[model samples]
Target chain A: DVKVTQSSRYLVKRTGEKVFLECVQDMDHENMFWYRQDPGLGLRLIYFSYDVKMKEKGDIPEGYSVSREKKERFSLILESASTNQTSMYLCASSFRESPLHFGNGTRLTVT
Target chain B: AQSVAQPEDQVNVAEGNPLTVKCTYSVSGNPYLFWYVQYPNRGLQFLLKYITGDNLVKGSYGFEAEFNKSQTSFHLKKPSALVSDSALYFCAVTPLFKAAGNKLTFGGGTRVLVKP
Candidate 1:
């Protein structure tokens, strides 16, 4: 089974602080993705990486950035965390454009 | 450009009764459709997908989906609803909505409520 692990299950940060959410996959999938889930909004893609150091912006990339320095790890970075950035963040990986396996998710709260 | 629409915000059903969650999509090329379930405070889990081939595809937890190409719909179904089945259900289509890429475009989501 594919296992995707997020660095933190829950996190709290103050407004204007920077935050990082890490994700690692054991399957060495080529594609990695970051998404945020909100009530009535579902899962909206923030960023995705197809290969090492290769990144692409998703629908809601306004306040997010991503890093894929290695095939197994993907990190999401918030330049300046704001209250509006508080949401459940999910990471996913796939071998290609195939079915994705998702991490448990990190609930971020910005105060 | 590709997009997916989940029509209902919520679906209520009695335990042991049949259930259905509707989804429709638009894409320039053949679309890869998927259904995911999210329990409270948890990430989305893959329920099933319709890539190509048979219209009816079965998946985990006694769930199944039918892909109707003519109607541009792929709806999730279950024979009997269980109390544990209450969760948020999302339908996704790839590539992203209004983009010619490989990312998935998820519907706003549908909350399923199974009453006892």
Candidate 2:
């Protein structure tokens, strides 16, 4: 079975604070993704990494950045968090054309 | 651009009753469609996918989806509903030609409520 782990399940931060959400996958998948889920909006992609040091912006990538220094780990960074950034963040990893395996998700609260 | 739509926001059904959750999609070229289920406070779990071949694809936990090219729909169905089957369901689509990376566009999700 594939396992995707998120560093934090829940987090709270003040406005303008820098926040990091870490994800690690044991399956050695080549593609990792970050998404935010909001009520009524579903899940919207924030960023994705296809390989180490290679990142691509998703539908809503504003105020967010990603790091893929290693194949097993992917991190989502909020350079300066805002209240609007508060939401459930999900991390997923997958091989080409394969179904994504997802972490439990990190619910971020930016006050 | 690829997109998926879940028409119903919520679906309520009694246990042992047949259930259907609607999903439709639009994309350039062939469509690679998928259905996922999310329990409370859990990440989305892959339920079924329609890559090609059989129009009716069976998946995990007794769930299945039928792909209709004419209608551009991939609706999920089950013979009988169980209270445990209640969850938030999502439909997603990725263009087949763009298979380099698995970039999927998801629907808003439908909350299924099964009453015992």
Candidate 3:
């Protein structure tokens, strides 16, 4: 069984504060992803990493950045958190052509 | 660009009744389609996928999906619904590009309500 674990389940941050969401996967997958889930907009991709220190911006990468310094760990960074960035942040990892295994998700509330 | 669409926002069915959640996709070449289920406050769980070969793909929890090439549909189905089956389901499609790094295009998701 593959296991992906997120750093937090719920978080609250003040406007303009820096936020970091961490994720770790036990499966040694080569691909990792960050997504934000909203009610009507669905799960929009924020960023993804294919290899260590290799990152790609997704559809909605604004106001978000990601780091994959280590194989098992990936971190999402919000340079300046805003209310609009508040969302259910999900982390996922997978090997090529394989199904992604996702962490439980971190619901962040920016006030 | 590749995209996935799950037409229904919500599906309600009685327990023991067959249930379906519709999904359609658009891709340039042979598409890899998948279905995932998410419980409240949880991450998405893989259901099944249609990569190649057979159109009917069976997955966890007795869930199956049929990939229709003509209709561009991959509708999820189950013989009988259980109350525990109530959850949010998402459909996803993989792009044809190898450089895409296995990123998945996901639908908005459909909420399933199984009533006893």
- Top-lDDT candidate index: 2
Clashes of each: 0, 0, 0
Query: Could you arrange the candidates by DockQ from highest to lowest?
Result: 2, 3, 1
Chain B TM-scores, listed for every candidate in order, come to: 0.93, 0.98, 0.95
For candidate 1, write residues A37-106 as lDDT tens digits: 8888888999998899999999899988888999999999999999999999999998876688899999
DockQ pick, better of 2 and 3: 2
DockQ metric for all predictions: 0.53, 0.82, 0.66
**Residue B17 shift from truth in candidate 1, angstroms:** 0.7
Overall local distance difference test of candidate 1? 0.90
| Tens digit of per-residue lDDT, candidate 3, span B10-104 | 99999999999999999988888889999998999999988889999999999999999999999999999999999999999885455346788
Highest-DockQ candidate: 2
| Candidate 2 local lDDT, residue A86 | 90
Off by over 4 Å in 2: none
* lDDT per residue as tens, model 2, A1-111: 999999999999999999999999998899999999997778899999999999999999999999999999999999999999999999999999899899999999999
Candidate order by TM-score, decreasing, is 2, 3, 1
- For B5-84, candidate 1 gives per-residue lDDT tens digits of 89899999999999999999998778788999989877789999877799999999999999998999999999999999
lDDT of 3 by residue, A14-104 (tens): 9999999999999889999999999866788999999999999999999999999999999999999999998999999999878889999
lDDT at B95, model 3: 58
